[model samples]
Target chain A: MNRQNSNKNNDHRDDFPGSFRSNPFHVPDHYFDELPGRIKSRIEQDKSRKRLFYLRPVVQKALLAAAGLALLIGLAIALLHERNDVHVYIGQFNGISAPDIEATLLPSDLDEYTLVSFILETQDFTGMPSGTDITDEEIKSYLLETNNIEPLILHY
Target chain B: MHHSDEEIIPLIQDESTREKGFDRLVKAYQQEVYWLIRRMVIDHDDADDLTQDTFVKVWNNLDRFRGESALFTWIYRIATNEALAHLRKKRISFSFLALEKTSTAAIPEYNDAFYRSDNAMRQFQKALAELPDKQRLIFNMKYYDDLTYEQISEITGTSVGGLKATYHQAVKKIKKKLSLE
Candidate 1:
């Protein structure tokens, strides 16, 4: 099969009768004489390039990965610091009790239903308020002791 | 300066005589390797650059030679690889559109002073350029360089039978392109 193909190619070449095979390209004068020196210089230049700053692909990838890891760690640390700051600010009210939260609630902050529940939880069915000797602290204590009502209804 | 591989390998291995050995190797194989690359690239300048790259690789990697193949075959393999890599980087292919682009742009104009003024040669080059990269290499190795199928197989890592068939097909294609078929 190979011989047949070769013979066919030969016959084709014969039929063509003008297939030029000699090298048609020409180089600059003295190119061959100077090529060895050029190659040597290039090799030296590459060696210097390696010595200066050429990093292997593996090393470059590792450096990128390390940098990414460091950035992630830094962000995590920053988030934890912010979280700790919030904890510290909340801890500042250590001496206060739940009454302080209830004391800060505006009238607008409580709906009418909550107001009714509050009233039922705090006061007895003694109708409207009269000019009696009922202290605010006594009312609060009744709210706390009678129905186990939490004084802190307003969220922060 | 015509040192055999046995003589050149030792010089390359030795620290003192390495440069001298390499010089001889370049002198011995440079023309053959250059022409091989030249045929593949079809431009003298690109071929020149790739030829230098091939030798530089040879100089750096000659120490790894384990005598599995002839030194020249190893060098041919390196040269072939350099040429193919350059074409790949430049996105050159042997498709019809690619051939048109190469003929118009990549190939040095005949008006260039270094280009030969032979129309037949140019036509043959055009016919050769129409082949795919591997087929072109096979044709160049077998038809032009007169390398045996086994030697080409070593350089290209293709089986001998495959290379023979490829070479024959390449010839047919070139012949057809040249309007000889």
Candidate 2:
């Protein structure tokens, strides 16, 4: 063991003339010493890059999802409105009946109903209001008495 | 005392939390973030924009973080996705490949590969840009970020095996294109 140890020591003797060598333990002094401004600048640059790298997908998805949700709601509203408009119809006329018995004659005086039992459909195309709450017998008598002129044609 | 990335994330959850912890997290991880983005984007400005975008996302979604992955991995995922998205929107010219004898003669020479190559990094950037978007994302997460296939699988909703295949294929294509053995 002593002989082996001696040989090992002798072999290592030429490898290092002294225990302290400067080769492995050196760096430029300023390499470890940074000015505050420089360090701060490096830090800012770092933060800037990191911030961008971390937020990319989330920001994009947020904007895209918001736009998508808005479109969906808008489309729904538009579709509902279109559906509502599909079932409607409109008819225009000048008058109602009761004591008046105008029978929905047009404002333009296009025609008059000469028949006693012609239809008087509501504007909604449903049944009429039963001759505006007047009796049919009274309406007929009144029409006969006035020679079929409108009862409310006061000047006549 | 400085907080770890995990500690910093919760501070990013609220607007005020960001006010308190954002600068800290930025200071803490900026070098890793910058080089990662810089290497991927190639251009300094593009890197800058993408880096800022990464943080804003972190700030907004800090609350959603469930501690399932390391903070480093999570942020890396964001960065990779952003870099790929930016690349997708870029309209680099294919004119370099077009012949002068063709009508494309009037076009100028342009290639996405020119700016980024300083080392393997440039090739990595180009390879990343060339890949289909999701594959590029998977590559970035796998190669640079050092994320496991399982973590990437969850983040991207891809199967782990699929991600592995994508990463392997991407590596091969990049190697072939860049003439690496």
Cα error, candidate 2, residue B25 (Å): 1.7
All models, RMSD in angstroms: 9.4, 16.6
Q: Tens digits of per-residue lDDT for model 1 on A9-66?
A: 3433343444465556677899989998898899999899887565677788999999
Candidate 1, lDDT over the whole model:
0.73
Candidate 2 per-residue lDDT over residues B121-172, each given as its tens digit: 4444444456666675666555544556766776666898898788878777
Candidate 2, residues A49-140, lDDT tens digits: the string is: 88998999899999999999999999999999887664341122123234333443323342224422222333232354665776656765
In TM-score terms, candidate 2 sits at 0.41
Steric clash pairs (candidate 1): none
Q: On a 0 to 1 DockQ scale, where is model 1?
A: 0.17
In terms of lDDT, the best-performing candidate is 1
Best by TM-score: 1
Recovered fraction of real interface contacts per model:
0.38, 0.00
Q: Candidate 2, residue B121: CA error in Å?
A: 8.5
